[model samples]
Target: MSQSFAIAVVGATGTVGETLVQLLEEREFPVSDLHLLAGRDSQGHSLPFRGKNLRVRAIEDFDFSQVRLVFFAAEASITLEYAPRARAAGCSLIDLSGALPLEQAPRVVPEANADVLDTLSTPYQLASPSAAATALAVVLAPLRSLLTLRRVNVTACLAVSAQGHEGVTELARQTTELLNMRPLEPRFFDRQIAFNLLAQVGVPDDSGHAHSEIRLAAETRQVLGDSGLKVSATCIQAPVFFGDSLSVSLELESVVDLVAVREALEGATGVELVDAGDYPTVVGDAVGQDAVYVGRLRSGLTDDAELNLWIASDNARKGSALNAVQLGELLIKHYL
Candidate 1:
């Protein structure tokens, strides 16, 4: 890789896309030229890059010839359409959708899987795991490194922004109308999301597990490199605007002390340990932060080997955009 590289940011106007741009600047990734690509509806709009405004271009019309890397934050369908072309154009693609399975494409978490990303071919590519999965992975990394993880049970409280801008607007509108004592109308979500929580994100399968829950469970095991680990998850949509919170319980191989556990988490990268006594973390505080804030650490009274903790992160940033950008940096350092 040269001192500076040409980069393309697909879906350049969405929440995650906006964060990607900010992170690329904050981290000082070498970028000589930046191309912003979005859908037809978003063309003609401009977003600030570095200091000047960069106009959004229609994805169909943007040329990938000079692009050395592509950071995709668009829908899975859009990724499916353009990822291969960008790769064939000799550009490394870092996807942020679950459109492709891990077997076909590398499933990456930069802090946990940087070694896997070290080697890449001309068309090498990968997608980030889900927000819920990413949060759990951060919590599980230190534990997996020290002890054998047997099983994990997680319940995720996700924000409306996870559904995109429409979900956020719908929640706000519903809140205002309810305060005025008017009838509520549902749109982006299956049920009312304001002043309430839904235990479902995607449709439930015959096994009674919602798709988001299933993905969290499966993806956690994969990212932790523990296929034999048993995982059960429940995903809920909260009224919050940003951040993802997870209450996690782990069953380990042997007994572990709380002091040892705290040390492990505190020493881990991309994670911060907040002592429950003085500084408690919330969705608002977790937003715009790169590290996952973990607090409320406790031990299972019934089983000494088991541990529980509360973890939170900005789902759109640390969970998605920052993770993608981190992978981009890794690619630049190792393969670019």
Candidate 2:
């Protein structure tokens, strides 16, 4: 018989957490026993796993010592509260919340920096990068050899789903109210988000940078293992329901060859290159897919040293749940 281990999925009722449970079943992860946990309000809910419905218990009431591995797909506050408990109980954890610092729980995307895992010891703590950073790193990690990257600029058009179920529900409600000619009152968002794009995803800091932008840049640099890489990230809230779209421009040390860039993206793992004439959209190509769809490959109009492209990916799945599961797989196979 194959060796199996006990695992727990914290925040099991949320979008990413629920998806992580499904992937754990779909991928046939070596799970001997599964525990589902969430906040107080989400308790009593049941999620199906391997043909059985598992009830989600409150995280506050659960014991961390029962599981060997845990996936923290909850909000950052939740992860911050329970992570130390899980760690003290000798549970290896993968966090998708981006709450923990890099020194404590290093950001990791298996496609980009699986080697980072080798340097760590047991009772491992890892972070699945934010959706935008994960997608960007997957496409950019492969191109490091083909180009001497000097700077990376990204405009990430994020879907409402990135804000969790409340954001999605609010978007739907706002759209319906507008179409029905009813008064528009934004609840989850600060302003109207039905047909308009919010320039910034969150409140800006003293430097005029939103938290998401800062996180995207920091996580991208860490995952790609280049601390000195210049990354300017802008996160915009789009009216879409799912998936994230990114417009990327890379400044290189020398002139870039279009053909070589195309070939590199084509061969890169976890990336799909769209045809030159046609482009990929979040709904059409990336909503339910694992690969980051890349299109509109071109160099800068003024500078040949610049390379530009567009990327679309499912933020919840490929960016959050799947990456966490893949990290779990890596931890079990080698580290654990």
TM-score winner among the candidates?
2
Tens digits of lDDT, candidate 1, 1-336: 458999999999888898889898998889999999998999898889889999999999777888999998988899889987887788888888777676756767876766666555656687788888987787778766677777898889998988888878989989999999999888788878889999888789998998788778878877887778899799999998888888888887788678878899889998888975644355546888988888888878889888888888889988999988888887787776
| TM-scores of all predicted structures | 0.95, 0.98
lDDT of 2 by residue, 275-304 (tens): 999999999999888898999999999999
Candidate lDDT values, in order: 0.84, 0.94
Model 2 spans > 4 angstroms off: none
- Candidate 1: segments with Cα more than 4 A from true spot: 276-279
Candidate 2 lDDT (Cα, whole model)? 0.94
Per-residue error (Å), model 2, residue 289:
0.8
After superposition on all C-alphas, the RMSD of every candidate to the true structure, in Å, is 1.7, 1.0
Which residue pairs in model 1 clash with each other? 1-336
**Against the true structure, whose lDDT is highest?**
2
